[model samples]
Target: MYLTFWGVRGSYPVPGAATVRYGGHTSCVELRSDRGKCLVIDAGTGLRGLGKKLAQEFRKPDGATYNLILSHVHWDHIQGLPFFEPAYIGDTKIVVHAPRAAAKELRQVIGGITRHEFFPVDLDAVPADFEFHEVVPGSAFEIDEFTVLPIGLNHPFGAVGYRVDADGSSMAYVSDTAPFDRMLHKQHFTAGIEEPSDEDREILKTMRANLVESLREVDTVIYDTHFTSEEYEQFPHWGHSTPEHALQICQEAGVRQLVLYHHAPAHDDDMMDRIAEKFGLLGKEANVVVCVAKEKMTLTMGEVTNPGIVA
Candidate 1:
């Protein structure tokens, strides 16, 4: 298995000199199985570039097929679908798997974004053959050579995290989730209670256990690290995690490598460099390989086995 980071920044695109090193585009990742099956994790701004490259490189007499696994329908996650150059090609087949409960709703959401008001061409008019699949959270499915397990994440509109395994290698993509803090659920109980009720505690325990199980022994874990601990304290309900939180999870799950991803839009290259250096040291101490996700960075499974940056 091979993985590439096309976009790492979160929230929105930040195109400027300050962000040139890491990336300006929002979330998107490309994964390739040993058998050459192509799977795209998200369709953010970076998808446009991936599409252009695919158009130039991938040629099939019948049609080029792509499997797109969407984490959610947020603008930053699906905004580039209409702009994807390959979607305009007459012989391209794109299968989009989303976390919507119904397939029709998924189609509606994708179609709504490409309506005449927003884009010149409607989604139905797109030249490619589009197939929408609704994926339920907590379900395991297979696409080509990859086995994918989708787990529910703690986001406002709901999100899904994916663990993909192929060729004896496994990778987990855990984006757009907040740390499972007990304080966040205080509203459901009496304010004076010093500790959560037994039921609440059990729920939290199960949540963390499930997440760790999904990532257990994975070769690489690309996790949401959209904030520092200080920043996460201020925005506890923002549905994002901190580098500290990511490190804790990786350590608990015994993951070999952890990629800190979904960078905050305001974090510049210098800030990212500092964060990477700090976490790199922490990872070294904990015996876990750690790196900050950068645009165009590629990692070949089984090639890297130490705690260090890939690029």
Candidate 2:
């Protein structure tokens, strides 16, 4: 199995010279089994490029089924769907697995991406057959050669992190979440310093515990590290995590490697380099390998044994 990062930026796309090295596209990743079965995570701006590649690879008349799992439907996470080329191919089938929203159905949430006012093509008019499945948090489900477990996350409008295990190899994707200590986000946003009730406090504790347990000893963890320690204090309720928060969880989970993902839009390549250096040293001391996720970076697993980067 292998994991490829097509996009790493958070909140929004930030294309420019400064962000060229690390990439400016937001939150898309591709995972493939050793046997070549494929599953995608998120549909951020990076999905446009990935879709183009997939269109060429699966151009046969019989077509192919592509499975995509999403953490949540913030604009940055789902904005690339309208441009996904395979959606224009008649024989292709796209299956999407995502967290169940509080008020909307899975299709309604996704189809909104292509609402006529927002895009030229309506989702219903797309050529490909799209299937939507609402994933229940804490439940395990299978997608082709992999087994996935969805764990609830602390994010606005709610979100869930995914742990994928296949062929004895495992990895987890946990992004767009806060540290779970200060805030308990729900379907709506909170305006001020709202403390959790006793009931909500217990829920937060269990949620954090569940996230750690789900990631236990995973080969790799691609996590949201969108804030610096200083920045986190300013916007604790913004639904993003600092590297420290991610490291703390990975340490408790006994994870082998921690890949810093969901880069803040304000962090350019130089800032990312500094983050990599600082966390690299911190991870070495913690006995976990740390890597910064970059666009086009690939991590091979399973038979590969060592999770080395491939050009």
Per-residue accuracy of model 1 over 1-311 as CA lDDT, tens digit each = 88888899899999999999999899999998765567999999999898887788667676888899999888999988988888888888889998983334888988889888898988889889899888876789999989999977766567889999987789999997877754223222232313447775676677777988889899999999999999887776667899888889999899999999999999999999999999999999888999999999998776444324333
In candidate 2, what are the lDDT values of residues 181-226, reduced to their tens digit? 8878877767754688888899999999999999999999999999
lDDT of each: 0.85, 0.90
Query: After superposing candidate 2, which stretches have Cα over 4 Å from the reference?
Result: 305-311
RMSD score of candidate 1 (Å): 4.3
In candidate 1, the residue pairs with backbone N, CA or C atoms under 3 Å apart (3 or more residues apart, or in different chains) clash, namely none
The Cα error of candidate 1 at residue 184, in Å, is 6.2
Any idea what lDDT model 2 has? 0.90
